[model samples]
Target: MRAGTSPNSSSCSAWRSEAGPGVRCSCPRPRGGSANSISTTDVPVLPNAGDYTIGVSIGTPPQPLLLNLDTGSDLVWTQCQPCLSCFNQRFPLYDPSQSSTYSPLACSSKLCRALPLSACHAQCLYLYGYGDNSIAIGTLASEAFTFGSSNNVTVPNLGFGCGFLNGGLFNNESGIAGFGRGSLSLISQLGVGKFSYCFISYDDDDSKSSTLMLGSAADLNGSATAVRSTPFVLNPSQPTFYYLSLDGITVGTTRLPIPKSAFVLQRNGTGGVIIDSGTAITQLTTVAYKLVRSAFLSQVKPPVANATAEVFDLCFSLPSSPSAKVDVPKLIFHFEGADMDLPHENYMYQDSTVGLMCLAMFDSGDESSTIGNFQQQNMHVVYDLDNQKLSFAPARCDQL
Candidate 1:
């Protein structure tokens, strides 16, 4: 996001001034960030299985629903009425009929045209798929979206997918709130070029919540910080995914001997490292994974190990209790211009259900590397889309 212009004032005024009447503005009172700059809205993070979800309301009366804040894809969608197939959800499905503000987009609409593979059948239909094979096939509709605790701040006529047929590992959440760099994404729709998020350790107290800020508040300027930023690589072919230049990783002081080209963008516009909030575990290329895994084992030597968890590559029994701290060294991710030192808890997970400690990273072959949300915990990460850079600063996420 660009700095200086306040989302609550100048930028918002510019946005609303362009739109004609009957469009209700729902801008919130700007919270102070640096005693002068507006602080970002803090949305409570709800723990769903291993994923982190935030509350979002849609429709006329603002029906409350929880959705995953995914940065990988671009489509803010929720399970709607007339489902052919859907996951068992904690909340009721969103019924567009109940909301007077809800309106379906036409096939010729600009929003529908922005979609990658939009289908026209009276209503603009869309088929959104995830890397996990989760598919959401539904109609594209626009409605008022309310965010934050008071639910007073809203974005009217926001484009979202009303998923009539959806299936995924969405445990209790309704659907995903896309923050990617696509035309129909919330970020693009709002025209806020900047956003930042601070994630807390999932295994920690559930009482504490994570934070996501939009607009000028997401800027690193006029703040006390140790922020490092790197240029974001945008592939015209895959615009939704935010690709970062990852040189190599370091276990404490020793940096791994991985080839630079191993993390480079391939001829197919793939094979670069991505910072994904939806993926629970971090994934590395096969060759890079082996080197890091071996380095981790040599440093953190745990005893009485067991079989790896269904997803995690490394798992071991805690010596004494679940709270017992493992002497794991800090994992430093060496990006092109930034060196993010991940805390021990950020890279390791303690399964409270089974009382086992495991490395929360895996090898997903040589397709592409991913820096998952787990590794992003306790870090103030700022995504500056306008500048095409990402900045990071280590902090206690709970405190932030």
Candidate 2:
């Protein structure tokens, strides 16, 4: 599901916002599934807010709530009952009192120690601040989380944040369902050690939902198309972010003169490229972005004009009669061990009302870069934490 918000939200900073219980519970094995895998279908939600959201069922008597499927954060949280002050949410608030499985953590728990300057009282209370300045303050609890599967397999006593006060650019969604690499992340807690997802086109109005697979079934190597694999780097300082070694970028057959060192991981663990699902547009280093933009503009010479839209930097205005031919070049990201040849639809976004198409990428002021979700559409991407590798293969996500 797609939620609407500002297009520039792709720059949303990385990292989990709050701390929660490190508790984990075993989920029932899925039916007709492999001995080691469990798969969940994620519903795609499109609000006027422009953010990608999914419906998650939590509690003993399932209470459905919409949340952002974020890879950059680590804690799965939702606004709960007895909200002292909460943002306006579209979905119903989760009430722990109504569920027999809901269990709030104690202040002295080790999970609370994981949080920065966490405070304890009768119940374990936590505070999370997001990159966009959004804040959620509430209790850390564990409960049964039911994924959308044919058998409705449920993961009991899963740790999560129950927000009593939330404020930020949530776009009315309940909260965030983090899939980061931290111990409290969905993948880490479930002990899946691997996960994968494929996003459909953002313009696909008919896209009902997508699938996020956990365990062996998440592997994309089974595809007929050869899956390109790349080394996945891990930094202890920033455990939540997934770092990739991007050597350079190519427009069609031409490889731009981007220095390999520009993509190198810095000692601080901040200077490198990361694949993030929360961001909507790909962000490149200032040097890399300029080269890519210049090369693309030279190849596709549309009318010399600025984008009327605030979010995009490069845009093209078409003639009175829409032009059938828009020469968008292929974007291939040269990683350390693999190259991802992206489709045109991944790099270009069209505003039909204005007859304008913009490069759905941006320039990052710092050395760090982000490969946004838009560029990953219709592609099956696998994250194998156990093997410390990332792989991908092109596929029609909707049909998959």
Candidate 3:
């Protein structure tokens, strides 16, 4: 999911500031070429199911954080000391006082240049917004980072945010472990080289869980489908964005018949189908949005009127008739290289009122769309940078 100040808030402009002298921006700018072009790499054709999760550590004891495997962000941050208003979770807090290696970034430091602040004062603070309307703000600093299941490897001098206070869903989260491509992010710092993959599971309920693979590939159950990888545009001035050549979308067996021009690439550099674990719902463009929602409602028997929520564009009554079977066609997400099909559970939800409802499942706040946790459930998603491709495999998250 994308993070910044509120859409209407003037304070949100902090994301565009320029770095001062000698300080370098972590995001890589486009090198003057066609935007959608993929770099030269060996596109490994592997069977779906070899999905794995990347292990992210938060706090001093380094509690293992299971993230949704996102490619849209770069800075990996977590909750820390003085978390007076935080939510319930198993992770520990990072106490800045305890680590002798902890060093706050100077206002004039290159890292602070791109952030929105009145001045390059070392006292500036950074904050992030969540879907649940939670906010986390803190000073930026360099600390130690360790990855892997054995927890044997460690990377020192890692730049991360140490949030002292956070609001909303963030209170429940340790902090965000960003997986965007940049020098400040885990993938960039570990020298693991470019390319990592993520495997997400599809679950209708809490049973869903997924994996993120760093500098390696996870073991898929051998039923994975490979999709073409679109080049990532790293906007040096703002957050990173993942760009995929989305040809079209299909509901079950029927194609929505929407034009390809509807889904345009974002120009701000940070544009594309942003994959995020922290967000519970998925956001889509207006055209793709209408088609997906219409197809979902058509499948459910006894048509229900759309309900209004602050975020979601459409919601339907749970399918009632026991004889009424919701035949969700394999929702096909057509990228340039391969077409990926999502199972029924990805869009259908059993609600408290409506027994089963076809959820539009996403929101586009302004205009951009996001692929959040709800869509990632019950599927193994692989982000292979080495081969410049993305892969997917279905999983039994009901067992999670």
Q: Write the per-residue lDDT of candidate 2 for residues 246-293, one digit (tens) a residue.
A: 988999679999988788888887789999888778899998999999
Q: lDDT for every model? A: 0.75, 0.73, 0.50
The runs of at least 3 residues in candidate 1 whose Cα sits more than 4 Å from the true structure, single-residue gaps closed, are 1-42, 220-225, 308-310, 321-325, 351-355
**Per-residue alpha-carbon lDDT of candidate 3 for residues 7-114, written as tens digits (9 for 90 to 100):** 221111211121111111122211221111112211111111211223344334333333323455666566666665555533345556655567777766655564
What residue runs in model 2 are displaced by over 4 Å at the alpha carbon?
A: 1-50, 221-224
Residue 84's lDDT in candidate 1: 80
lDDT of 1 at 370: 91
- Candidate order by TM-score, decreasing, is 2, 1, 3
| lDDT winner between candidates 1 and 2 | 1
C-alpha RMSD for every candidate: 8.6, 8.0, 12.3
- Candidate 3 ranges with C-alpha deviation above 4 Å: 1-70, 83-89, 114-124, 128-134, 148-151, 194-210, 218-239, 266-272, 305-324, 352-354, 363-365, 395-400
Give a tens-digit lDDT track for model 1, residues 33-87.
2211223344545555667776656776566567898999899999887778878
Leading candidate by TM-score: 2
Residue-pair clashes per prediction, in order, are 4, 12, 46
